[model samples]
Target: MKQDIILKRIEEKLKVLKKARPFPPYLVKKLREQFSLEMNYNSNAIEGNTLTLRETMLVLQQGITIKGKSLKDHLEAKNQAKAIEYLYDIVDSKKDIPISEMLIRNMHSLVVQNIDGVEAGSYRAHDVRITGSKHTPCGAFEVPQKMHELISWHKKNKDNLDIITLATEFKHRFVHIHPFGDGNGRVSRLVLNILLMKQGYPIVVILKNEREKYYRALQKADNGNMEDLVFFIAQAVERSLDLYIRAIESSTKENSLVSLSKIAPQTKYSAEYLGLLVRTGKVAGVKDGRNWKTSLDAIEQYEMNLIRKKK
Candidate 1:
């Protein structure tokens, strides 16, 4: 039931975003800049990069290296940003772009260019295991064949499946393939957003703060369960949608995310309870630092559902 509501909201937001095209140049520039920073920071952070979101902005936009951060961390930020730009460049220049293995390798090459120079774009040459998971990655010899099968699977189902399911499944499958020696998670996310962008959906960021939950969801998918993983991706997609719409419309009251305490006053629930709902996936909200933020619009939807359930 919660998943349905979340997916429905995603469609609604996506529809709004689609109708707003051809998006203005300024809007595109604004959003692309913000999402670039977001993708660079959060994706690297998930893989244990230590740069805070602000520090990421400094490194990418201002080229100011932090005193204590490792050069590798800075390189990860810059490399990931370039990977994001590469995707945007292709999406802008091409029409009906099919995601091919070549494109995947190209993105991987950008992701690990200097970090892992020798094997930047090549598939791993040895067996790899997912940390803290029961599923073992395919042997090095199988990476090529498995990746070929993955591309084939995507081609076969790309159009038939809904957008979230298609992108999310492709992401998990890519990470499951674990083709690269390192940077699989980061590359998987980059490719995932490219697929989303190809279909006109916004860049979906799996949050750094939710890193543990994200992994657990993947582990479950490895065990043949995908519901949790789908919703996790869905929430991120919707959040981006919220941001784009709020920016485009310049109307934050209903679309913008506010602290839970502010949102709680508008509904019958208390802030702590709403936080619980956010954590348990009963409502749509985002983790901002130590606090959780939700929109009044989401709480209203929850209340409306409650009324319907009673009737």
Candidate 2:
């Protein structure tokens, strides 16, 4: 009975999400395809629950594996992966790990394991700055010593503030510190996801395709306008939900048009529930087919939509 009530509540929440946008069927189809491609790529190995360190390394290297690197050099690219996995394990333990002095050194130590001149787990005594891109002005920035206060503020406000907001803010600060000589971007994202996953949210992979938007959002955060960061994260989260939902929905469709009947000891079918599924793009009927299939992203989106109420 309790489970049934919870499921009903989920259904209601999805109904609200579905009604938020009356997306055209063609738009839904396009979004589903995008979701399918990304989710499939992400789930290839590292993004899945049963992630391997090596696999995670390969995935991260995919970001830096540029036009000039040899296959051997690329395959040996394991430092970032090792660092991220080690940090993931540490953070996943749910310990109240110190973030200020410890996190930078710890992350830097891990980042430089295979790189040259980067002392394992040490911060630069001297100042460091990034070269200007077309979007950024060329200027040397002294790494702010203010991170001590920032981390302290985070620890104190971690509970009171929204986890997504806090996580995004933390990432912004890490990048601003430019703590490490290199690998700062990857480390910061890994740290953000670690916080997010610990908070029970899914790991959001900001795809290469969305780099412009991602960078712009980061810029907004850097400039002290956090709303852009929040909006960006929300959109990414929603996109992830869309992908997972479509994948699950696709699986259900493959099994049968009516998968609920496959749920063991099923109760009477709810027409309202079926309608909700259709509205949310969880179920789709082919022109010549009698049955509908549930896309994985659709189902996952529905689940996440329900989870928002808990917040």
Output the number of the TM-score-best candidate.
1
TM per candidate: 0.78, 0.54
For residues 160-199, what per-residue lDDT tens digits would candidate 1 score against the true structure? 9888888899999999989988889999998888888887
Instruction: Write the residue-wise lDDT of candidate 2 on 123-165 in tens digits.
Output: 5555555543223321234444555666787889899876667
Model 1: which residue pairs collide?
Answer: none
- Each candidate: RMSD: 14.0, 13.6
Best by lDDT: 1
Model 2, residue 47: C-alpha shift (Å): 20
Candidate 1 accuracy as lDDT: 0.84
Clashes of each: 0, 24
